[model samples]
Target: MENSRFWRDPAVPFIEARDVLDGRHVCYARHSHESFSIGAIVSGHSTYLNGRARHRVGQGTVVVMNPGDVHACNPLQDQPWAYRMLYLDTPWLTELQHQMGLGAHQDLRTFATTHSDDPRLFAGLNGLYATLTNADLAPLAKHSATIEFFTLAQQCLDPLPQRAVLAHDKLGRAADFIRANCTGEVTLAEICSVAQLSPSYLIRAFKQQYGLTPHGYLTDCRIQFARAQLRRGRAIAEAALDAGFADQAHLQRVFKQHLAATPGHYRAHSSIR
Candidate 1:
């Protein structure tokens, strides 16, 4: 009983405490998040079916899920599967995406990945929870924990695309702009310069190609870059600059638009393992 309780709650706000479920408690109904959810399995095994494909999840393994990645979990054996997890916001992830040079897209899905040889990924989370509950740290303390967790998650992010969809011409160009200049602030005009099109023309062409205007696409790019940086151990403020946002607050505004959750929340949900 005590063991079960330990995994059930990390109790950090903006971060969903990890939960361990067994026996009849073993299934999650299909749903999506406005945030990111990172999972680490502790015991037994399970079959995670996301859409038509089924993947096995087990101990010491981590799963990175973006929002709207419809998935469900089932016990692999009568023994059942128990796990701990944190739910993060999308902008945080978007920041990571940008840092890692992954392009902007809103599709959130799940992928199985292995991150580390250290047990600290799991142990550190527990310790952070204890610290948060028992000790009084400065406001930056929670951010520090979140930063650690995201650093661990960075190792776990493997871009496993279950399916592939090619980007359109204009959208592809805008994507090029994003990757090349992710370290500095960018605007629609900058992207238009690279693509050699008028602002209005670029906006329409980009929208037709990717269903997003140049500015919208750029914003998403910035957000993903921020997430990637956080995952890479960069501070949110640093992530903001590295991802080309004007500032941390600017990053937050754009992050909230796509993820509906804050960057801080996103980092908290990203566990180290």
Candidate 2:
């Protein structure tokens, strides 16, 4: 279909992914899968039903389905929506759980959470999707990222009986991390690791302390970087790429959102003597 895209590689056989840019017309009946499934709502809203539970999921919502869980999601009132889904082989994921020392080795680790809106978790999933689909990146990088993201998924989404206490002791360190990596690929896991904060704790407190979510702050940093470049009369597309935006249009959308002016307008005015 015109709205669908899929990414899978022979080197990474355990994972397969698909993203639907406009899924309002797409419909599905209640069904179960043999593999574990995780998905994020990229935009718009939908009604999500997993077994007896039902919830409305919007942008940034991450939904998890265990193997054989009957579930279905459809657009809310025919509204347009976009989403990304990743399915992992059950045995491979169960082995990963055992390797992570999450719990008993006998079964797939059940995620008590059917869904989450945690910004860190949401951003991590998007970042992972981007990485997994990248053609230039090495297979080893994709493999490492898959492991890192699922590990964080477990930490953020599953019920843990005895986890070590974590604190927001390094907000400055966190900001510095974002600033340093504004022009490169960065992950929520790295921010949590460098700041010594848990994923669940990092996003909310970072927003409270910095007045922006970690992803938001990163965008702001990139905007600032691009703005500085525009002041020097650099081209919009070049500035966008150097600032780590996906492309010029991405920079344009966000630049306008943050500055309330187009990049071209800003650059034209800034070049005045």
TM per model?
A: 0.45, 0.58
| Candidate with the greatest TM-score versus the true structure | 2
lDDT of model 1, residue 9: 23
- The 10-residue segment of model 1 with minimum total lDDT is 2-11
Q: Would you list the clashing residue pairs of candidate 2?
A: none
Cα lDDT computed for each candidate against the true fold = 0.59, 0.79
Off by over 4 Å in 1: 1-14, 21-23, 96-139, 159-273
Tens-place lDDT digits, model 1, residues 117-193: 34655665555554443335553676577767666555545555542443556556766876577566677777877
> Per-residue error at 140 for model 1, in Å?
2.2
Lowest summed lDDT across 10 adjacent residues in model 2 is found at 159-168
| lDDT score of residue 233 within candidate 2 | 75
* TM-score, cand. 2: 0.58
